[model samples]
Target: MGGLSDRFWNGAAAQLVNAIIAAVNARDFDALERYATADLLFCDSRGGQISGLARVIDWLRDVIAADPSFALQVDAVTSSNGSALVTGTTVSRFFPEARRTLWRLTFSGGRVSEWRRYSADPLPVPPPLTAH
Candidate 1:
């Protein structure tokens, strides 16, 4: 938690991330219901922002049309308290480029309050500790 919010975020948050990812991959955004707060916010790496679930849905539909083959695969998840940093790859048959992606997610009351996509994975996971 790092003493951030009082909210508890861990495995459940990861699962929510995965579910959202799946919905995006399938282009079935209706599945995202109940996963986001009423005032959800979504932003792209380029600084474009979409507020509210309805706006987010419109933006996602546009994304799907522009990049039909774009897909995200989660490589790792680091979460604490109400925040999670997701590292993943985005590969598209249309683009044919393997790009590293970072998804920053914040949860509140078991639902996503904010989501941001970054073009790079900034925080590398540290090595595990050995017995002293």
Candidate 2:
């Protein structure tokens, strides 16, 4: 029974990842909206929060307008306890470099109720430690 449950969740999470990738690549705002709840909440690493589907759509549009070359390269997706954690790289046509980002999608009642994104800067190499 547990094995079946695990497979089921893994499949669902993969499906969700596929849907998101397709929607983003196609720039289909409707599909994105459908996958998310009406009162969806998106929180950025800076602690800024955007609530509601309409606002989220608007924000996404603005981002695309600012960076038309933006695309996602999903490295991995993992699901546990009804939430999916996506690790990926943010690729941009205009930018010369790719940025790393993590997305956490929380699902409820067949819709994503919350989405959190975390971005990071590459760490610098550490200096060699002296022998004691």
Candidate 3:
């Protein structure tokens, strides 16, 4: 039931990432925390830092309020040893921009031990519309 590198463990970890994104988009914080470790550390592209699951929950709530149409797209997943890295882009309707991010997850005893987030670039400014 608790073995790293096993098919069950790997699949569960992958699903956890998916569930986290879904919960974030749906604004279901309670469900989001279920996949996070207690000491999770999240760093936003804007240089904001959120440490621990409790703080993450608060930060997410604020984000949902500010950006009602926030959505995440998982682009790739890579795993080795006991760690997995998920890369994706987040699209926000309020600001109408997109940013790429990588989420690193570490597993221990079939449970998430740590989760860290890093962004590849700042949210880009959309170009103004012009008619020919």
Candidate 4:
């Protein structure tokens, strides 16, 4: 595992990313038990952070259960060096609009060691530049 090449690691990372998204969308976080390390840490864009796989799983469950229409549409995944970065659009009935979130994951011993999600809300476009 540790001796794997960048290509191999990246591929593995991508697979992990997809599996995580699927589980989250299904609201079955228990399926992620194998993917997360015992001491995994998850940090959210809302300044919320949780450590330990069990705690993280609980937190995810609450977030997913909050909105019945909650869904994540993954746009891209980039992986390398034991880490993966995933960007996706989040649609939730609880929110007024769609939001983009970037998920960064680090892997160790073939399980996710840390996960960070950064949420980015869309901003209105500004008017075109004009000479004063």
Q: Cα-based RMSD of the predictions, in order?
A: 10.7, 9.0, 8.5, 9.1
lDDT of 1 at 95: 47
Cα lDDT for residue 81, candidate 4: 72
Model 4 clashing residue pairs (backbone) = none
Which candidate order results from sorting by TM-score in descending order? 2, 4, 1, 3
> Candidate 4 at 60: error in angstroms?
1.8
Q: Please rank every candidate by lDDT, starting with the best.
A: 2, 4, 1, 3
lDDT string for model 1 (1-132, tens) is 444432345566778899988987888777876688878888666556667887777766765676677678998888886788999987765444678888899998888899987874221211122233
lDDT of every model, 2 decimals: 0.73, 0.76, 0.67, 0.74
> After superposition, which runs of candidate 3 have C-alpha atoms over 4 Å from their true positions?
1-9, 45-47, 94-97, 120-132
RMSD from true fold, candidate 2: 9.0
User: Over the stretch 8-126, how does candidate 3's per-residue lDDT look in tens digits?
Assistant: 65676678778877887888877766776777766544555556778767766666666676677888776666777898877876444677778887776654666665765443332
User: Which candidate wins on TM-score?
Assistant: 2
Q: How accurate is candidate 4 locally (lDDT)?
A: 0.74
Candidate 4 lDDT over 1-132, as tens digits, reads: 345577686777788888877887887767788778999888665555677888777766666556567777788888877788998887877568788788898999988899887875421211122233
The TM-score measured for candidate 4 stands at 0.80
**What is the TM-score of each predicted model, taking all chains together?**
0.78, 0.84, 0.71, 0.80
Residue 47 C-alpha lDDT in model 2: 55
